[model samples]
Target: MRENTAEESARLQSAAKDHLWLHFTQHGTYNDDVDIPMIVRGEGINLFDDRGKKYIDGLGGLFTSQVGHGRTELGQAAAEQAAKLEFMPLWSYAHPAAVQLAERIAGYAPGDLNRVFFTNSGSESVETAWKLAKKYFKLTGKPGKHKVISRSTAYHGTTHGALSITGIAGLKQDFEPLVPSTIQVSNTNAYRAKELTAGAIDVTDEQSLERFGLWAADQIALAIENAGPDTVAAVYLEPVQNAGGCFPPPPGYFQRVREICDQYDVLLVSDEVICAFGRLGEMFGATHFDYQPDIITTAKGITSGYSPLGAVIATDRIMEPFLTPGAMFGHGYTFGGHPVSAAVALKNLDIFEEENLLEHVRSNAQTFRSTLEKLLDLPIVGDVRGEGYFYGIELVKDRATKESFTAEESKTLLHGFISNKLFEEGLYCRADDRGDPVIQLSPPLIAGPADFAEIEQILRNVLSQASAKL
Candidate 1:
């Protein structure tokens, strides 16, 4: 019925159910509901399922494919690098690609961030940053500085150390008793400013961006105080917190955060796993936010998902302790600086520069924002917020009241209705039920007004239909 040869579809379904352990999926849903989307190919911003139906790349392959899919250049880069040097370790010696990429990343990083530690993916990058922060503090005679502070609803990574820093309770409950010494605090959502003058919040005037920034930043100081400044090693923050639905920091938020971190002698780690590499119209989210973090953990868009490569960039001050002869950190991944992956990353960065992808995203962010904001014409759209192409639409039961859906309502509405309906209608966005039942859109940077229009139209249709049912 879906225009696929029965045998081909059967083969895919069998393989999916038997061998695939999909991430963040309820495998029981496959009992008789729907077959998993077997995307065999992609071109530009469209994915071709095994049945040949094309869906818009609405989420940019999980926020990793910045330059879009089916890029022959990237594929060729990987292949060429593999043929020349299939594998190499960055233990004692480094490869050309890795060395070049490290230098490029260091050059691109702001302030004194002149050191890079490569890893296999964003999760590893997060772990590296955490370990480096803890080690840096310990080396500087602050053994008590071992705790990390992140925001509620923010996801740092899935590894034990990184997961400890992650604030999502759902993701960590199963893996409880994780590495201790992690704290969670309120995130900056100016849209939800409760009391602008109470509990270290002084940004109460409506739509006051600066006040919101100050109020939000004060939360970090509170966290540091509550946790004891001597026990806080670093504050890991994402320029645009994506899990809580792309909550871009209010103006001056990062600057204030940087100040608080420095005033407390705690390192600032910008966890830009999802926000870096052109997702926010800049090489890094810190650049977009106009602040300099002491350490930056990044992955996802480095190779545009062609190959796995993550880098933990550090300020010269932080790396100084590590460079004191024979201070081995004893941290190295087997494939951290894989020659092939590094080569692919280098090529991806080259493509970014050649295409002026950052500039493109910057020029078109306004259009993307305006197009998505059009959804506000609908009754259910409460807030349309984010930076650059990364955005999220927070839904509300009553616009005037800004009442949100209950957990049961969220499951039935977001998971049971809008998410499926949108995908069925040919858009691959996220109908997230995490903090709120928000629809998140982080399309590829290559997208323009047309792509944004398509996303908006699909969201409008599905969200409107779902809201009507609710």
Candidate 2:
């Protein structure tokens, strides 16, 4: 990779500090700390900071860069499409790349999700899904069905509609007066089941899976009842809730959720922003979990973050209302279905197939799980959980008692020790305080057993250091 000149690096850093405001960040800290990080290049699964220091991209570029970075094909595809036809709005005028990518995504999406509405990012995809659900209900003469539900501790996005659907309270306190019809439900974090269950999972001889599944799935039904069936338009969910750590759906969980949604006359929106596009060893995370949603919201891996792209794939039933000759959904963005992004996505999907990335993740997922589970020997690691290339290591105060950190301990340890140490040690995942102190990892889908071990070794080293300080 070509290196950034001293002059160029200094100029960019100055501009970033002076003008470019970072999102979901603290601005004051960058003033006196080390130089602002400028990731100049990336390849496979390694990222190079501006100073040319290399680090394993442990979190896959905020859980987006599944196909990895610095792939020349993605760049070439973008350039070729831009040169030919740069900007054609998905509004009245449609372009080939957008149309083609939509068809491709519809084909890959499970069930009857045949209509694709493109957007610029995950937030927009989420917003699109919520709007479609509400409008679909209105069109079907159930205009009273306007409320949406999601699990607690999940992070949907920053847009108002998406933020309203988010489950974290601390993040939304400032953004009050958000879209006024969102509800929260309990998420499936089986590691914390001791509180809900009288004892452990009871993974004994016969009903281990059955027992866990029933307990977890009931939470959604309970929430639906509390919210009242008539008012709920949709239930938005991630296959593995990412915010409160990666809590994968308990066995048979989605099946039960499906039944409840159907019974309540609610749409099931699989918000696959983090779990989609081969993160879970499949085109859609819904496929990995064996559930068919009425709508699937996706972004991130669609183009491997080469360019911005998001999509809301809805079934014909939901879309029919908006396109019945005269009626219009009346919602869209100029850059939502950018031809360049669509072209890049096509090439990204091509690379996924040619390299067999999804299959690679599926074949090696067990190794990833087993290697991370080995960290259980460390007392601080209470739970090592997730699926496919995505996973989270939940830290705790005690293993046997399933104790969690105090508020001060969470702030000091997660924000102070774990976050800094991991970065200092050249690993770039997350030490999240959103739900306990967890070291989250979702490397490129192409990673294998060796890469998993590399991640484990890094965590093992840093976490042990963190545990000692605590």
Candidate 3:
């Protein structure tokens, strides 16, 4: 990695501060004193900033880089595809790259999820899924079924339809009067089982955990009944909910949710934007969790973040109505399946198989979990939850009582300190308070035991400092 020249760095800083509008960013934080973090290059599991400082990519580049970074093959694939066929729309015609990539995804997706609809991002995939669900019902004579049910704090996407299905109120309050009839249900966060279930289940034992799982799954059924099943079109869920700090579903949770969806004629959508493509030690999170979904919305690792692409994989039954003569679902994106992106995705999947990345994750996931669990010895560490390479270490003010920080404390501790301190220490991970203050880690699937040790050490140092301040 080459360091940016002083003049080049100044130009970049000026252009960024003046012209660049970062997503979900607070631009006010940047100035002469506070420089914007400018990542200039990546190789393997590490990233190099403009200043040439190397840091381990603990979040897998926002949980998108499954095969790690700086894979020239992916870029070459994109170039070759762009040279052959630069632009084509899926509106009325298809290209070879899109067709091939869709077929490959269908092969990897679980159950009868064989129909692929492409988009440019996770939010678009989610929006596509909701529209498909509604259209499917309308075509099947249940036009009234347009409502969706999702878990509390589970983030689906940022587009209006996907945002409506999203359960985070903070992210939605600013964009009021969203799509109507999206209901919230209890999530399977076992650590918060006592609070989620109102003291009915504490999750002290396997039996109690199973009971809590059933209770949480039952919440969807209750939501459906309350929302009027006739008006419910689908229930969207993540295999492991991401927003509330990587809450893995309790055992038998998805099975029960599957049953509920089937009983109510509701489509089960597995939003795998962040969990697909070996992130959870499987091709799809649904496969890892052992459940069938009527639709699966995914992106992120599809092209390993080398290019933007997203997809909504639907079951054959969901596509049956639209397959009729002259019948159209009436939805499409201009860059839904860009040839270059599809080619990149195809190449990315090839790397996954060639390197046995999924197998690598499965073999090393336990080691990663145990390494992160070592943080429980810290006073501020309350719970460590998640599956595969994705995990979240929840920080509490009091470990014994599991008392989380107040909003101001969370802002001051996480945003004000831990986030930047972790980066200064050369480990790039997320310090999020979307649900509670947690250090979210979703390293690349290719990461091994050595990488986990490094991650744990950095986290230990920064979190120890944070605890002292608290």
Please count the clashing residue pairs in each candidate, in the order shown: 0, 0, 0
Better of 2 and 3 by TM-score: 3
Question: How well does each candidate superpose onto the true structure, as a TM-score?
Answer: 0.96, 0.96, 0.99
lDDT of 1 by residue, 369-469 (tens): 99999999888998999989899999989887778899899898888888888989999888897787788888888999988888888888888897788
Q: What is the lDDT of residue 45 in candidate 2?
A: 89
- For model 2, residues 218-268, the per-residue Cα lDDT tens digits are 777777788788888999989899997898877788999899888888999
lDDT scores for all predictions? 0.87, 0.87, 0.93
Cα RMSD of predicted structure 3: 0.8
- lDDT value for candidate 3? 0.93
The TM-score, computed over Cα atoms with residue i paired to residue i, of candidate 2 is 0.96
lDDT (tens digit, per residue) of candidate 3 on 142-179: 99999999999999888899899999999999998899
Top-lDDT candidate index: 3
All-Cα superposition RMSD per candidate: 2.1, 1.8, 0.8
Q: List the residue pairs that clash in candidate 1.
A: none
Cα displacement (angstroms), candidate 2, residue 11, comes to 4.1
Off by over 4 Å in 3: none
Q: Where is the poorest 10-residue window by lDDT in model 1?
A: 195-204
Ranking by lDDT: 3, 1, 2
What is the TM-score of candidate 3?
A: 0.99
- Model 1 CA RMSD to the hidden true structure, in angstroms: 2.1
